[model samples]
Structures are given as structure tokens and as C-alpha cells.
Target: MEMRKEKAALSSQQGLNHSPFHTQEHMRRVPPKEPQVTCRSNTYPKGFYCSWHLQHPTYIPTDFEVYVQHNQRPLEVTRDEVHKNRCHVKFPELFSSFPYRVNVTAVNSLGRASIVFLLVVHYHLHRGLFGPTVKPDPPEKVVAKPVANNARRLEVTWNSPSTWPDVETFPLKYFLRYRPLIRDQWQHVELSDSISHTITDAYAGKEYIIQLAAKDMEIGTWSDWSVAVHSTPWMEEPKPITSTTESDIIPETTPGPPSAAPRVGEPTAACSTLLWSTHLLLACVLLSIM
Candidate 1:
């Protein structure tokens, strides 16, 4: 047993001296061959289920090893084998916003290939059909009420979203939505051209929350819900004016005091002239008779 162990150790030392590390293969340096890599999509989201298909070019051996390098360091990723010209690679985390290169190498039964492939991994923003891209800006102000002549009707008035330098022409279409405050249901009213609307079927004295959204026609996107405004119709009953109590009635038929006669000496100038005229007339008559 001792001789057998000694013989095995001697053979191992001889093989080690003839190996590539001890010969010119160790001293000689060769540039790592750049493998041929291709990408399917230019942009991809992080943490989602996505695959990157990669394969080396035509070579002696079709086997290859895959690796992901972040900042020039090998990432902790398990490479999957492929039967065809494709291999699926998954990313656990998104490192940067820009593109990151993926390195792929080929290996065969003889030995691992020195060739490597570099692929760009593009990162995309996390977004859905209706994601959180909606801006949190407040909504415009709106006022609504019933007309005087109509009892079961309402008229709504609105002003554009208050902004500095005053928006000359509002480019967005307004969406007016309202429903009973107490109920869970709602009603939507879409105004294509007009900002104000006249709605008649609303309940009397009921409060409602009117919502508004500004549609960006340029980008064809709708902004988030603006700040909500509350509205309630007037409920006070109309009262008529009437004099029902005695205190409210006006007084009539008041009595007047008696008046005294004029003084006897006040008219003497006019009365004496009239008496002298009458005496002259009587003397003329007596003379005529004599």
C-alpha cells in the first residue's frame, strides 16, 4: 500500500510539470475573444419576469457559460443550458438606468472556450396601462345651482384651473362627474366642447361631489383627479308677507279739534267802505222823492 501511494504521488508531480500552467501556456498571453451576442428588446423593466436569449456564434463546441457583470464584478447568477441557439437569462434586480452589458462564454467537452459575448441590458420605467403617472395637482373650481324660473333644474358654472399668467385658451376638455353624497353610486357627465353644463334631473337640496379631470389632448393622456368641490342646493321654504296681528295693522279715522271765529275789528276797513256807499244810495233816493 505504501509503494502504491508513492507511485501515485510521483505520477501526479510529473503530470503537473507538463500541464499548461507550468509551460509556455502560463507565460503566453492571448486576448479573450469577444463572443457574438444579440438582444431581443432594447428596454425592459426590473424585477419582472423577463428573459434574454443568448448564444455564441458557430464554433467547434456549441456549449457556453453565461454570467452577468455589474460594475465589472461577476453577479451571483445561475446560467441555464440551451439545446437550440437560445438561453433564457433572468435579472433579479435592476442596477442602473442605462444599459448594462452581459457576458457569455462557450465551453465544450475538451475545455472552456476563451471567447466571450457582451450584450446590453436596457432598463425601463415601471408603468402599467393606468399607472401612477397621474399628477397630483389640484382641480379647477366649479359652481352650480338651479335657475329662478325652473323648479326641477340646475345650471353649472366653472372656472379653469387657476394658474399664473392666466391660461389664454384651455386646451383640455373638462369632465364633470357628480353623485349623491350619501350613496356609493355615481353619475358621469362628459363635456366635449363646453365647460359649463345645465343638468335638470338632480335632486333638490342634496349635496354632491363634483369631480374634474383635465385631458391633455396633445399627449392624449388624462391627468389625475383634481381637488374635489362640494355643492348643496338651497332648501329654505319661501314665506309670504301678510298683516295677521293687530299690532301690524295701520290706524285710521282720527278726530280733529274745533276752530274759533275771526276777531270783530280785523275787517273794519272793508266793512265801513261798504256802509258809506249804502248811505249815499239812500240819500239820493230821498232827494229824488222830495
Candidate 2:
């Protein structure tokens, strides 16, 4: 048993040597500042997560190791993959009168700093200075699209954060903000008991960026904004005129013979009488000559 314990300690020391937070060389070395720890559970009662950070910069490569204890028994601390200084610890047993004790150690070539935080679970004389409060995760599955045939309307829809356990019992309110690419200002709306909203005043044909944030209805602060979605309001399309329609608008004219000349009026009766008299006088002169 002593040999096994020795091997386990050796393995843990080796793991620390390979941690990404540590570096061998020190340039502009400074001692680490006091660490601040925050722990919360989006799924309260089931579990909690603890994260820590430094108030001031150390100006050199630093290493951090976190240890957590509940009722004098050690709990497993999982370091965050993306954030080296942050870690998570899950509750093995729920609803305890004892407090969780967290110790954070910061080390560098120059010096080291350490701070311990005590967080109480299941209350009594522990005022919750360092807490396991209920903070929700960001809203998810956010989508934005243009309303069909509505040039000025853009519709946005989202689902509750999946990490939240019971949405119906512990409702969440949402905050939505959207803005067109051409403008720096954003339009915001607060919604409860609804997951969708239609922007009736959006600028037509303008592309917009939309995002959502969430908080529990009765407790905790708002979560971070979800991934942004891009969409543009609908625009009316012009209809094309076909050849048949154009022909109907302008009718064809058929060719026909040229119009006949206007008719001449008959001679007056006075003119006819004058013509007869002249003819009789001409006949008399002809008889006399004979």
C-alpha cells in the first residue's frame, strides 16, 4: 500500500510538470496576485462549477493548481480545456450542511501566491459570500430569417439553453438584440413566455446580425450572448412582361385600299338655262346665214 501511494504521488507530480499553465523560463518575473474564485451551477442541486482568476497580471509565465474539499473528503477538480486558470468541480453528494473549501495556488520562477474560498451548500450561518448560486447558460439554436412577401419584416427564433434542466418549472427570460450591417445602433427586445419575435420595422433589403441572452425568471444574472445569426429582410421582385401581354397592349392594324375621291355636285338650273339660250341663238345665226 505504501508503494502504491508513492507511485500515485509521483504520477501527480509528473502531470503537473506537463501542465500547459507552467513555463521554465521567466522574463519580467512578478509574483501572482490574490486569486478570486467563483462557483455556480446552471443545473442547481445536481452539480456546481468553480472558476478562478487573478485581479492583476504577473507579467510572466505562471502555473495554477486547484484543490477542493467537502466535509474533509477531497473532490476531483477538472481543469478547463480552453482556459488554463479555470477549473470545474462536481458535487458527489447533494444538499449538505457543510461548506466546500477551495484552495488555489499560483506559482512562477520568482514567487507564489495562494488563497482559499469557502462556499456553503444547503445553507445555515453561511451567508453565501462565495456561492453556488444559479446562473443559466446562453440561449441556443438561434435562427433568423426573412418573412415571405414582407419586405420590412425579419423573424428571429431561438430555443432555451439546453444545459438548463427544467425550463417549464424554472422559466428563463430572454434578451434579443439586432442591428443592420449599415448601422452601429442595435434594436433590443425583452421577451418572456415566447421564443420567437418578428421585427416589423426592419429596413427592407438590409442584412442584419442577431444574438440572444438568457437569465432565470426569478434568480441569477443573464448569461452570455449566443452565436450571431445573419439575415436580410425580404425585397419585392419585379415581374417580367411576356410577348403576348405586350401584343395585347398594342393591337395590330390591317392594310386596306386607299379611300375613293370625293363626288362632284350637279350643275345649277340657272347655268343649264343659260347654256340652252346660247345654243338657240347659235342655231338662228346659222339659219340666217343659210
- TM-score winner among the candidates? 2
Q: Mark the regions of model 2 whose C-alpha exceeds 4 Å error after superposition.
A: 1-27, 54-61, 70-74, 92-99, 118-133, 241-290
The C-alpha TM-scores of every prediction are: 0.35, 0.62
Mind giving the per-residue lDDT tens digits that candidate 1 earns over 97-149? 33334556655444444434444443334321111221212345666665665
Model 1: how far residue 267 lies from native, Å? 28
Candidate 2 C-alpha lDDT tens digits along 228-254: 999999887889867676547877789
Model 1 is weakest, by summed lDDT over 10 consecutive residues, at: 41-50
Note the clash tally of each candidate: 2, 0
Clash count in backbone of candidate 2: 0
Q: How accurate locally, in lDDT, is each candidate?
A: 0.52, 0.80
Candidate 1, residue 270: how far the Cα is off, in Å: 33
Give the CA lDDT, 0 to 100, for residue 117 in model 2. Answer: 83
